[model samples]
Target: MHFEVPKVRMHSLREFAQHYFMIVLSILTALGLEQWIEHTHHRHAAEQASEQIEVELRGTLDSIHGALANNARQVAPLRTLKEAISDDVRRGLPDAQINQHIRELKNDFVLSVSWPSFATQSWDVAVANQSATWIDIDRLHKYATAYAAQRDASNWVTHDSTIALNGPRMVDLRTRINLGKDVDPVEFLGILQQMINTSTETSGHLEQTAKPIERALAEATN
Candidate 1:
């Protein structure tokens, strides 16, 4: 069996062009609106991310301040330890009274010395999602610089902690006290001096690094 072809109507060139123009215009308009919506959503997300990051940085600053104060409190004890050790070396272990001093050093200084770490979740999220790019370049640069300083401070803290945790001095102190054995005062004094210097420098640098970050966060929030 043969099938008959159906009759079809064809458009004039002018009608076809007019239809084509409308279709293209509609597509372009839809694309423009979609792009605008996406842009607005991204900007809003970025602003939220900035605000959260600022709050987080403020918290980080507070942590740094607490750590600084804690470190500062160790200074006197460290000096006393140095002096006591020196006296022991020059003369002899002072007396039972010195045991009180030793206990104080252990309680106040050794146990108290610690490293501070901050949570950067907001910052990490913003950066990971590329929302940080929405912030002005200057402000972004400021944030980056502050974080860089924090990274340096963290490195110093890690170095100081390594010395504290792994040094022979800590072992010697523990052994001397627990066993009531005599430590080589001269060797102990040298180690104590190095620790004092490390703690002082690390605390100072951390404060300096954190202060600028705090100020920047304040400005950003404002």
Candidate 2:
């Protein structure tokens, strides 16, 4: 008896093609889903960061404005006391009263002057101590410069206003205090106040803008 060899069965061409098509479609779908998930996650993270920045910026602005107002108030009492003492001294008032007033004025002046410097120092510390990324640093620097310019201008106005108020009538006192023609204290103080206001505003804006950038950076990094 002769045995016939069995023929091997093969897959039809259509079935082979269908199998490969399904595999390709599955892989593409998986990749698409992964991309969508990643995009959504990044967007959420960015929004969170932006919100945080906005809140922080507002707080910073409030702190700065409060400092400025404090500085402005402090200057007034010290200035008035100084003027009184100086006027008494010029009019040949009793040595005891003059001396006492002078002492008190000196103390007040010292305290009043200390605040503006302190406010500036605080700002410096806050900005300088930040350990943000380079982009953040750059953004901060720009914000700071603009703020500083505004502060400087405001300070000038305040000084000028003060000087204008005290300069004309108190000739002997002005001379004693070395109040030059250019030294208008009121204007200077006004200018200083304006500077503070401007700086506060600018800082607010910067603080607001920073949030978005931070979010963007976070997303990019993620």
Candidate 3:
């Protein structure tokens, strides 16, 4: 007797297809989740780096500001001395006495004040290196250099003028009645006063420009 063979079931084929589709869907979902996690981690790391940079910049700026403030304070006495010299010359004090006073003042400025001014400049250079913002770095460097150059130039000019008025030797010409006869006190005082005024104005401008940098640093830290 011949046995009848059973037909393949259509339902089984459909069930197998559904099982494979479910596996593919699950795999796709896992891949998507992994990619999202990696992206999030990378973003977090970048943000952390940015925050650390900002903190460092702020600390640098604060130190720079302290140095600037101290330097400004040191300059105050120099301003007073300059004004006094100008006033003395205007008052017709003997040229010899005025020259003597100016020489002493210059000595004191070089000995006592110059170091702190130089220190402030060093701080500025350091800050320029630490600066993250281009504007802050550029402006600070420019202004600091300008101010320092101006101060040095003024000092040189004053030194030369003093030498000219005092005559070729250390002898005070102002005290010599014959030499004083030819000296123009007004012109000498005018030159000194103009230098003082320029220095003062430059200082004010630097101070004003520094505030924005300070504020930006503060905000970055916060």
Clashes of each: 0, 34, 0
Top-lDDT structure, candidate number: 1
Q: Mind giving the per-residue lDDT tens digits that candidate 2 earns over 1-222?
A: 223333535389886677667667777787899899977765665444434443444454455455556666656665565467556756876666654554444444323321222124434434454422222454445445534544654565456424423334434333433432232344333333443444344334434434443444344345
Per-candidate TM-score against the hidden true structure = 0.69, 0.43, 0.50
Sorted on lDDT, best first, the list reads 1, 3, 2
Model 2 C-alpha lDDT versus the unseen true structure: 0.46
**Candidates sorted by TM-score, best first:** 1, 3, 2
Candidate 3 wrong stretches, greater than 4 Å:
1-17, 111-222
Each model's RMSD to truth, in Å?
6.9, 13.1, 12.6
* Candidate 3: pairs in clash: none
Cα deviation of 114, candidate 1, in Å: 2.4
lDDT of 3 by residue, 144-213 (tens): 4434543564465455423322233212322332333333445545544444444444445445544554
